[model samples]
Target: MENANDGKYVHINGNDIYYESYLHQQSAKETIILMHGFLSSSFSFRRLIPFLQKEYNVISIDLPPFGKSGKSRRYRYSFENLANTVIQLVESLHLTKITLLGHSMGGQIALNTANIRPDLVQGVILLCSSGYMKKSKPLLILASCLPQFHRFVKRRLERSGLENNLRFVVYNQSIIDKEMEEGYLAPFLKDDIFFALTKLIRDREGDLSKDILNELRVPCLLIWGEQDQVVPLEIGKQLHKDLKKSKLIVLKETGHLIPEERPEEVFHYIKEFITDKG
Candidate 1:
């Protein structure tokens, strides 16, 4: 299961978190923390790490129950708990000035962290982030109301035959190749991981909107894919309006997984943003 790009693991609070650190030898002035989306690992940033590592220290962690990280039966896998875990990781690494970049569910975690600990975070970059959207489709509302039905859907998704279905739901089917499909499906193949995903989905349904976006004192960047189906493009536009100091960049012909589909473009935007701030 170990790849050449595999990072070191650290046992924190009874959980083994898979984390990769770059530029360890150099004296880093600041650190950039990359958070992946739901059902995704630090592997999401595989394409951008080399370019970023050369300049600033780059760190990415696989959250509990995802990737090679430990799965805890004790933890409820809530957003609050995840955010707390991330804060602990930051403290452990002795990172004072950190730029938090999160995609999808990770973005929500970043927003929660900023709201709770503004002093620790310097800036934030959200990619197709959740929150700020209230419209739930009838099917979703029905699934929420019926616990059994929700469980059934979850189980069905984890089946090997449903890999294509899952990929279609997450990304544009036309762009999903064999390798990409395998990468997305590899995580759900494990029973514990699937259970963890269900827990995450339940917790994600709760409200995570923040008023801090309107009063954001720190620099922020919002990147979204124009063809994004999960979070929708309109939500990104709304976030731009909400965050006063935010810059929104929408990549045309891209889908929900912007980092994977448009790595070079996304990397350039982030690199320039961080450099300009300094």
Candidate 2:
């Protein structure tokens, strides 16, 4: 285990998962865990953390191979493993019951974890979550075998350019500021990420099936962006149907980055839902 201002690292399953803990009032009973999407880190939750920490203990995690976490070539990057890693982290912290708030790929992981161990999770909040996706194509899997192919991954990602990527992430163009751009680009400055991503492509499995999703009894609150290009509102609709205990809210003029696009509104809904459930 290691500690730094960026966050604290806990060794789990042979990899160090970097995370920042904002333990608000010790009297606060609920703990909310924040999980970021693919290629994103704890940085994405910066806007919402302050609001949550004021009322609940908030913990933001940088999933393995992203942010300051260890980028291990041997660690399996499958969603199940990632979810298990998250579970291990919760166990390590001796958390009794927790709520998971995950965006995009992180939401997928959140569902996977809840389904695996319902007793540990009190509820889940999925922000424009990715759902019902097929596995990586055979061609991509074969390409992952090429020696030093990580360079190609790096090149393709860099070619897209940070500004262009941010434009796609949020519907409000004016919100794309220097800080947001720099936050997303910071981890890429590390050369090891490309190789980890290469391994990730080969290890990733398809999203959970409807039958599996149907088994989850944990309550959920899903917030979606009406104009989300990455994961559409329909996907959230499908999730609401599959996860029987879930309710979804869609925000207008919002895109893939729900938290970044509507932090205050999201917080309001979250407070209402959590408080009502309690």
User: Candidate 1, which ten residues in sequence have the lowest lDDT sum?
Assistant: 198-207
Global lDDT for candidate 1? 0.75
Give candidate 2 misplaced runs (Cα > 4 Å): 1-6
Error of 1 at 77 (Å): 1.7
**Model 1: pairs clashing at backbone N, Cα or C within 3 Å:** none
Q: Write the per-residue lDDT of candidate 2 for residues 1-278, one digit (tens) a residue.
A: 11222368889988988889887545588989999999999989888886787788788999978998989999999999999999999999999789999999999999999988899999999999999998899999999999979999999998998899889989998988889988999999988999999999999999999999998999999999999999989899999999989999999999999788898999999898899788
- Candidate 2 global CA lDDT score: 0.90
TM-score of each: 0.84, 0.96
lDDT of 1 at 15: 76
lDDT by residue for model 1 (16-119), tens:
78888775456767688888877788877777777667667888888787888887655656767788888988899888879999998788788778877889
Candidate 1 — which residues are off by over 4 angstroms?
Answer: 1-6, 133-154, 159-175, 201-207
